[model samples]
Target: MNPGLYVFDFRFTEYFQMTIKPLLEEGKDGELIDWLKDISLLRRGQKCTNPDCQGTKPMEWKRARIVDKFHWSCPLCKKKVSIRTDSPLAEFHCSFKIILETIVAWCDGISLEEYTKENKNVKGVIAKRIYSTCTAATDWYMQTHPELTLLGGENSVVLVDTYPDGCMTTTPHNNNYTKRVLCVADTSHMPARIWAQLIDNKILDYQKLAAVVVGHIRPGSTVVASPSLYPLLHGVKGMAEVISVEALMALDPVDYQRSLKNLETIWRTTVSVCQDIQNTSNAEGEQMLRELEWRQVFPTPLSQILHDLAAHATAISS
Candidate 1:
């Protein structure tokens, strides 16, 4: 029987922890498949995609002589398709449970090698494919969301800082390394919106740097940045005010102390995220930053996160 698609429910966080986790721990593959189907992660009464089929009918889920264990059959044309035909698991040939656990591992920031070591059922090659697919879906999710581009609003506190990322630095002797990254943290709400751009060691264009910073921030907003950035951002259009960290510290010691703490946290977090990738190109570094930005902006529950990713993949595949 087909179950209704799950809505964005935070309660599922508890449900997953209480029920699904135990089921997985017990190695109940059949129960896990049932739960996956219940959450719409696996196809149940999905429509047949065969263009040559005679009628538009709901595909039936039945046992199949394959590794996936189940296939969707078109009752009209007898066309059998894998249960993962159109979901995020479309290209993954692994079992449903393995793919689901791989997704969970990816979302939890678990390393691919660590995941394969823990789950003996998944091979190195298969885990890599799953991880790659998850990465692509994440990129698509972040790229499609237009609201993630610009951050902060009028009368909001925006913290801007620079961090030197080692991962983005390819070569130091050749002078082709990424020098530092300018990061903006919008503290208007919880789980602040973060945006960053890598600065090349060779190019120290202040005008270009100022322009990039201005593009990410909205007008009538207070910008808290380093003293060096003051001249570059001074008298720029639409900014409510620009204050140097030193001057602000002198003006209001309490607020300035709090801002210092926030700045330190932001830098620490950025460094930690960048260090996760080892010796990457500028393009890959930027992509990682963008993904980081996306995560910071929307820190939803894992269940909803996976569902949204699956929906995006299904749309593209269809």
Candidate 2:
């Protein structure tokens, strides 16, 4: 049996022990995978590049290459391939084991030094590779996952805010510090969709922010945000209405927190499980990987926690 494939079997055991069992005991496992799978993050395999073929089967795992990544092949076309063929992992020199480890570390928020030490690789190389992979993944996730982008419809509301990051600062002028991001959080989905930027901290710059937001969110979607953001968002098209975050703060804090907490918990569970499945690169593991990717677009435990934090903050002022 392939070692990479074994990783997923181990992961299944771990997931069942840690998450599935408890959910079953609670009588919730009936739809646990369905619920979790809806939001789990995994990769989607594409069809054979051969256009003439009527079949639309995804590439399948064949064996591990000498370097240790799982190889794939299209049965219909007789084309042999590897997991990295169409992903950010493509053309990577590291083994599948190391790539999986690096992905887990990233999801778990491990430091660069820790990842380097654990893998016995140079810190700079590890950082650069992980960064490239993540940035690529982020871009791919945003594009391929329509749920993450669509924000317009009945009862849909878009939330906007900014978070401070030390790494974002470069040269400074007026404030000597750069508030390099403006973000839009769409509450249209249970987990919410987020778009971020590295930009100057000018309020007017929100026009660009609005453009990004409006493009994803349908025109006539309700928009909500802090008072400080209203002026910046004026005259943007596609908004049916704009509400102050203060209005949201008016809701019952306890209720808001409870709902937010549950949402985050589910999101966290989904992300954790998905990352674990991706770390395993074998034939058996491939199925789980596909399932996990299918669910990745849905909200997970971690996202719920973040959303709760945002919702609670908004509620406090209401």
Candidate 3:
């Protein structure tokens, strides 16, 4: 238990890259299971969580009916909690292998229904598991990484825009819902960044964009925006540039088409996937978004990415 480590160790990424990735790549999920279990159980010397007996006894890790987990029985409290008590995997009451494979499959953009079909499990189980675990983990992650709480705070060239959310059907004339996003990029960073929110109105007016820009972007950064939002870019603390379709019509078509090509491609894909669920709810839309964000930022295996995002993002105990 590295209780001494309060702030996250930067080496965590390197550890995942060097250690875990090698094991998984070699198709050694068995050994990977052992390593995951060891890491989760010994994450830190967790104290007995019982109020009356918060003692420092070495808990006995009992093998349960579950495939790859331990019931850590506290000596002082004589109580049992999962070794996953303080980890992102805790929300999943299933085994580590199921959790790990689920992460890998979901990161590959397999929907809950598809995953359940492939695994031949009941739909409700997988849906509930993914929803509870991923959502809880994501919530914990955002709360912990306050630096990344709101996007565009770092020195970045933010491209501000809106697109149809596609959570519902859209008629040709009137869009149903919209998603406003700040696409932040540093030529230095390999992968550009994005932060998004569902807005009730399709239009992102000056007042709306201005209210968001002040809270999100860092002071004195450059901002390239869509024509509709071009007027509001000045309301932000950045050097603003416009990239409206009308303005693009006057410029070289190639450059104009290329500006937001990457984000547009992803947004289109998200819209398609999100609209598939029968009676899609707000939770499902956000779940898809969370998965998209996680896949974008972390290139490691699903298990490692989930852990890194959830565990080190905040301190936890059970």
On lDDT, the leading prediction is 1
Show model 3 residue runs off by greater than 4 Å.
Answer: 1-34, 41-57, 62-93, 121-127, 149-157, 165-174, 177-188, 202-205, 234-237, 240-245, 253-263, 266-291, 301-304, 308-318
lDDT of 2 by residue, 1-318 (tens): 112211322223454357444543433523442333233321245466777543778777555544533455787887765544544345446643454445444444454565576666534585557644443343444444556445555577766544332111122324332333344555655544545443445455556766665676677778775556666565666588876654555663754544334333423322233334333444323333322332234322233322222333233335
Model 1 segments more than 4 A misplaced: 1-15, 22-40, 44-59, 65-67, 74-79, 165-179, 200-204, 249-261
Q: What are the Cα lDDT values of the candidates?
A: 0.67, 0.46, 0.50
- Per-residue lDDT of model 1, residues 1-318, tens digit only: 001111233334675578657666654766777777676676666777778764567888788777766778889888887776666667677766677667666666666766688888888898898777666655667777856768787978777766543222222333343446787888785766788777775877989889989999988889887767777887788888887776666655663465455565555545555454336777777777776676676555366557666676676867
Q: Return whichever of 1 and 2 wins on TM-score.
A: 1
lDDT of 3 by residue, 214-318 (tens): 566565555555566667665444443433433544554664544345445434433443333224566665554554444345534355455654564245543
| True-structure RMSD, every candidate | 7.1, 14.9, 8.4
Sort the predicted structures by TM-score, highest score first.
1, 3, 2
Sort the predicted structures by lDDT, highest score first.
Answer: 1, 3, 2
Q: Clashes in model 3: which pairs?
A: 1-44, 1-45
- Pairs that collide, model 1: none
lDDT of 1 at 220: 82
User: Total clashing residue pairs per candidate?
Assistant: 0, 24, 2
Supply the global lDDT for candidate 3.
0.50
